[model samples]
Target chain A: MTNEMMMLTNLNCPTCAAKLEKATQALPGMKSARVIFGAGSMNVEYDPNVLSQEKIRTLCKQMGIGVATVVPGPSSDI
Target chain B: MSRYNDWLIRNREKLVIATSGSLIVAAWLLRPLGNTFHFWAMTLAAIIAGYTVAKEAIGRLSTRQFSISLLVTIAAIGAIVIGEAWEAAAVTWLYIFGGFLEGLTLARTRSALRGLVDLMPRTAKIKRGEELVTVSAYEVKAGHVVVVLPGESIPVDGKVVAGRASVDTSSLTGEPLPAEVAVDDTVLSGTICQGGYLEVVAERVGTDTTFSQLVYLVAEAQEQKPKVQRTLDAFAQWYTPAVIMAAALVYLGSRNMHLALTFLVIGCPGALVVAAPVAVVAGLGNSAKHGILIKGGERLERIAKADVVAFDKTGTLTLGQPQVASVTGFELEEERVLSLAAAAELRSEHHLATAILSAAEKRQIEPAPADDWTIEAGLGVVAHGPDGEILVGNRRLLLSRGTDLTPEQAALMVEHEEAGETVAIIALNGQAIGLIGITDPIKPDAFGLVKALKRTGIKTTVMLTGDNPRAAQLVADQLGIDEVRAGLLPEQKVEVIRELQKTGHVVAMVGDGINDAPALAIADVSIAMGSSGTRVAMEASDIALIGDRIGQVPGAIGISRRILGVVRQNVVFAVATVLLLLAGVVLQVIHLGSGMAIHEASVLLVTLNGMRLMK
Candidate 1:
């Protein structure tokens, strides 16, 4: 029952120097994530049992171009 | 900005100038009569009188009476024939004074309508490649970022993408409170950024912006009253010929030129002609002062007859803001649930998102930052924290993630949805924790206005809205509306109005939008939420409620009916008295000066009756 998507951190913007900001979405297999729009970076919160962190990064990369990196949230057991 | 309206407004001034100039020339030529003589004054009076007649050509023509110019000319000729040189001069000069007074009154009205032009901002700072370029507000567009310094008007309706500020929306909403907007919060054009520098991404600019559209719509509505089919239609068609025939009959039967002349003066139609327009102008002017802009005399006349009233539900009968109606879930505290949801939605910008954030703030719940947050446009937001993953959005977002819901929770959602409530779900990790119900509450006076209209013999009160049937019906039921037409787009709303009209119902549709414009234009009398800053709705409407309150709709109708009643009373008295006095003149019982006295009395009587609308 541990909410796993909240622990992700360490991000950068793909397009500019703006820092990554925490954002929320109602997407499946992920509870929360940090997004850096300018640098195309995402730090996702999810239960690895339902969605792997790698899959979260792929989802972020496919959603928009210029995605730089995807890191695990704080709660994630990296 | 159509060429016609431009020409009309521009030419209106020119007409005044030409008429005044001609009168001055006539006055100068008559200097032989001496500076103090009435003849010189008459010349100046003729010019001012000429413009008043010319400015309202359609109004004069609508009543089918001899122009005020012709009336003054005839009076002067009569004085000349009577060898009363001073009398001719006095009458001409008095006519000019009256015309000048009318011109001044009308010029003030035009200026009032054009007041919005002064509010346009001089320049906007557009961001390009880290360098800012100054441009006029009209040149900005969507997606362009603009920097707004303190005390500057927000050049367009845009979101604060960076920085924070306190914005005063009082100019648009008339509310005294200043709103605090952070990143992603939307601000409208014309609102002053009170403090702090904020970079806004322009969502709408120029004519497409809300403030410009608001002024434009008001101007458009103010012009909808065309001069055609004036209330004097009946009198205009018959009065002139009737007067000529009556004069001929007097000359033939009495064999007296003086009797014929007396008949002409007595049957002058002055009272009859002035009665309709003065009442209309007064009614229109009074409504404008009350924030209700009636486009024309035709709207006033139509409203006087409209019996079926239709309403647009959202923002019209309801408060038009989403609020948390109820919270369901016992496992976690309500405050904690709201805080979690607000934290997740902090980065999002949506009407419903703002409602949730405001709800949490009302409970004194301070939201803690979530480790990771993502917002799905048109769905919901999700947050990841050390405890678990939380989901907050509509049903689709929950189901797409394979998130299971308890049968009881599912039923509760259905119940709220059926009643037109927007249910904001809160899920902790993968399990549903609670749900927040949001709805736009109905206005307090909505039901009262509906019942009042019904009691006044309005045949039907139909509710037409773009919202779902459940929500629309809920609002309609509360207001005791007889019928509900739900889920109608703007065009559909207009079509519904058109259909009702085809069935012989004189329908009035009340709405606020560009979408509502078509329906408003098609209705027997389109009433717009003039106070709500819906420009398209106001522009498309025949009548706009300056206060944006539904109560004004019925109040306007009441005023129109009362004004019409007075108009009818004056019409009957004026027409009957004029005919009877003409008969008396033909019989040589009424003297010339006495007839003029009575004639002036009738004109003054009608004018005083119409002035009651000013109260």
Candidate 2:
């Protein structure tokens, strides 16, 4: 499993953030997903063989969240 | 096509606002021509604005989630189904506009941390063989020589190997004064050099620097939810589903789907869900910018309710450095007695030895070499010198050596001890010679801090120390402390804290030593002072004051209290708005557009209230 963090540009509502986290976590081979509403970022841990970073970004975009930047590894700021 | 799709994705909100707004304007302009043109224009407005809301609602529904977007989508579709296209268009447009305003206001609250991140210099000047080269700050490796000119930010944590400068450290320590840095002095990243050029050997780069650690700690602190936030989240979990069920029952009972749809619109608890986290983020971020690091939301709550505060003495209340206060010689000059004591302590590694050596240095007395040095634990040191046998220790050491102390000398020793000075007896040739008084002076802000804590509603301020009772009492009296616990071992300090907790007092322990760790862990809130150099103390503390200023204690507590007040106010405001909107919907006084307008206004108000802590 690999952990990654991405800047979420339009994550405005807490309810939407919670849903985004749940949807990401429910993905196959995913460990956890945490969306920090205040910081406007999402952290996810998932198996690379099951789902790629591009697939994760696409999923978030389909849910109306804009992923501005994707960086390998969890956010050190957290 | 992909480029256009990307543009549409980036500007989705703005597109919704513009399309709906222009269609509504066209509907009004075409009203006089015919009802057909006006009706179709209003329908187009509703569909364009409702498209995204419906998409989000359906997406969440597929995942078995209920959200505010779901409520807004239901309301807009219901309005359109009832032939109220204008109401549907207005509701969705207003919701999107409110979200845009909220995003702007939320960004303002996060500006504190953003300012800190911006302070880091982007590029650094480093020496590469003969020529100087510029590189990204994060790319500067350890052991590289970085050059910092005046008015430029230091790019990495390093030691100065050449030149001198005074640097502004306000970003790190919250101290307004600029610190003068000479050769071999360590300089921190993110601080600006105010004068002179410096060549610093990088020791810590990237995230290892103090500035990065502070930013990381603050961000992590903001993410930790408080008990209040957790409770609210749990309440929201049931609230959303319950509201939808209630709306279904209302429609069945009253046979009025319009009122039921309005119920759903008002039921979205957007304001309540955001109240505490927004306040916690802004409060923690503002405090971190000022060099006070409250670990998390739980610690902030503890600091708010703290009634009694306990302070450790040595490095906390007083300057930890002890200095020789006075000297008295029985049958010789004061200078000779100090010289003998310094000579005997030249090879000793005791704390008192440093005091005596510093005192001798102040008097321009160079300590002579001594031989046959012997140490008696808990007593003093004895040595054979060129002049005679030198003895420097406590009264017990001198007495055990068969040295007789006159009544006058004993009285003077008692007097010095009562005045909060540690008395050390000096003897020569196995006879009582003189005595030296060493004292750790109280910090200049000690008294003021006590008064400030009292003003912040602290019921009692107690001083805890391992010093003699008389000395502890003397310092306590000067600081106006309510109680003094003296002669306590390290474990005894923890016992004191537990006793306070047993008595039902919310206690906060402030200390700056390894001995204070246990007590700090047991207290309701533990604060560590001078955390800039002490990683252990920072780890042990609930709150770490990077600066050694005693005044920040009250400042931190006061900030916590204000944050708590704001959080409570937001919760109350959000609940009241929900109740009022529910009542308005049942009475059929509020339509879809008006209900959404009020709902969005309430959320924005709560956000604005939380942002007040930024100051």
Candidate 3:
């Protein structure tokens, strides 16, 4: 499992962040997902074996949310 | 070609808008030919535009929520049901176009912080066993010496161990000027190195860096809504459903399908929903760009309306560290007097003791061997020596032992006291010798900041200090402060702030947030100075100025007022536009197309107004 931060785009309301958070959490192999609406970013902890970062971007795009520039987190201890 | 294909797929909504919008224009142009040609063109336009609207509406309905897109979709379909194809086409087209433009602008505002995250360096060069190796910035261990070259960002928070360089700390301080750095100086992550080489030992990496904390703080600030914004948001929640129910009522009563649909189109409250947050986002961004972080929209509101401003004198006004400025001895040398005071204060922990000890050491005065050092509460300490018993204290301490200050000595003590120095009188064997003058000079920014605060309409400026009256008065006089509260403990500062607040004044206090925690917490708006180094400073205060300059206090207040003003204007404008659009529908003067245009225009206008604060 690894955790990463991704900058989200076009989030006009805080509720959009909530909706996206719920969607990401429901995905398989995801330990947790949180979207900070004000910061336009999301933090996710997931098993890379079941779900890849590339798939997360595609899923968000389908939901009308754009995810850009995946920032690597210190995933060792996390 | 692949990028072009990606763009086309991503912007399919725009394609729908373009195709439908052109169909409407085609229908208008072909009107001269016949009603049949115009009817078909308009019908096709309605179908094309309404498809995207319906997709979005269905997507939202699956979530079991009422959204603006749902209202727009229903309105467009209702127009088509009434055989008003032109109205149906115009309604959907206007909604999509307005939404497109709104998305573009709001996206820009949201990127203000995303831009900061992008600047974080992803890689670092760490020295391995024999050679330097490139590693991910977060993977680098603490104490590893990392090399930063010209034009690259420093990847970790650490002190420079080698090399001379000019570093741009603008990312951290919002200052564009390159700060000069050499060995032993501290450098932070996310700041670019400009034409200089430096080796830094990694201390805090990744999210633990000060720059990352700033980003997180700003994000947290942006999420917190002000009191007025909370009220407006609650109103918007009810207003949208009310508009839907009102439209249902209007349709039942008048059976005017067009009028009811028009009401639905204009009643989304889109502008009002976005008004306050957009302004707040812009305001926070503007302040962040200046290295000043306001806690939240609520804090911004309080700062904007602050009436009385209070300050902590030591670290907030003067440089907190006192220094020995002058030493005067009537019958002995100046260095001898300093050595005598230093010996008496050798085991003392008073702030002024450090000044005396440093002064003696700088002059290479070997401290006279002394024993039995005892400190009196208000007076200085007494230490016994070989030749005669040495006494270093105030005139009262000397008077108690029957050694009063001579007239000339009294004049000298008064001069040093008036000059804002804490003087310690040194006496040997019950006779006065000389005094060491220790002064904590006022910061250069304090005087200018006071005048600026006055110009910004801060009616009363107060100075609260734990120092003596003479020292406190000296600062008050130099800064032209209106009120001086001297010899105040931390709790007394809180009382002073509360007293001002009782008289119906909004108070703002600026302090170091350590000893001044009580006053800072009690004040309406607490501003912490030089918060770049400590998390406690940011957490304890309502606002944090990362730089040491207190002059930004007035600037922060002024900018907050302007932001608050813009927020009010946006809110009022949003409500007025909605009300006006509804009135047009009631008077039979507005249709779905014109109503959607006006609503979108108002929303865009409000967003643009908020963006003005970004500059």
CAPRI classification of candidate 1: incorrect
Residue-wise lDDT of candidate 1 within B1-615, one digit each (tens)?
Answer: 546653554354345455555555566676687665545455444444444443343344454544534444554455556544444444444344444443343334434333444454657999998999999787787999999999998888888899999988765555477889999887888788899989999987765676665554343443333232254655555665566577678779888756665566566666676666556556665666566667665666678778899988878889888888887774888878788888877766655777888888898887776788887777788888666787888877888788867898899888877777888888887778888889998887686888788666677899988888888888888788989998888889888888888988899888775556777778888888864246556655777775576877877787777667777777787888888887787667886557666766777777778777777
- Model 2 reaches an interface RMSD of 3.7
Kindly report which residue stretches of model 3 are placed more than 4 angstroms away from their true locations once superposed: A1-3, A10-16, A46-55, A61-66, A72-78, B1-5, B32-34, B51-65, B127-131, B195-197, B324-406, B424-436, B454-457, B495-505
The runs of at least 3 residues in candidate 1 whose Cα sits more than 4 Å from the true structure, single-residue gaps closed, are A1-78, B1-68, B84-94, B97-101, B104-111, B114-245, B342-354, B364-384, B391-432, B443-447, B455-457, B466-468, B487-499, B514-522, B530-534, B545-548
Candidate 3: residue B615 lDDT (0-100): 86
Worst 10 residues of 3 chain B by lDDT: B530-539
TM-score of each: 0.66, 0.83, 0.83
**lDDT of candidate 2 over B46-105, digit per residue (tens):** 888878677767776676766677777877788778777777787777777767777676
Q: Model 1: how far is A78 from its true place, Å?
A: 62
Candidate 2 segments exceeding 4 Å error: A1-35, A41-78, B1-11, B25-38, B59-63, B120-164, B181-189, B196-206, B327-347, B359-377, B381-391, B400-405, B426-435, B536-540
* DockQ of every predicted complex: 0.01, 0.26, 0.41
Ten-residue region with minimum lDDT total, candidate 2 chain B: B530-539
User: Between prediction 1 and prediction 2, which has the larger DockQ?
Assistant: 2
Which tens-of-lDDT digit does each residue in B131-204 have in candidate 3? 88999888978899999999999998998998989999888777778999999889888999998799998888
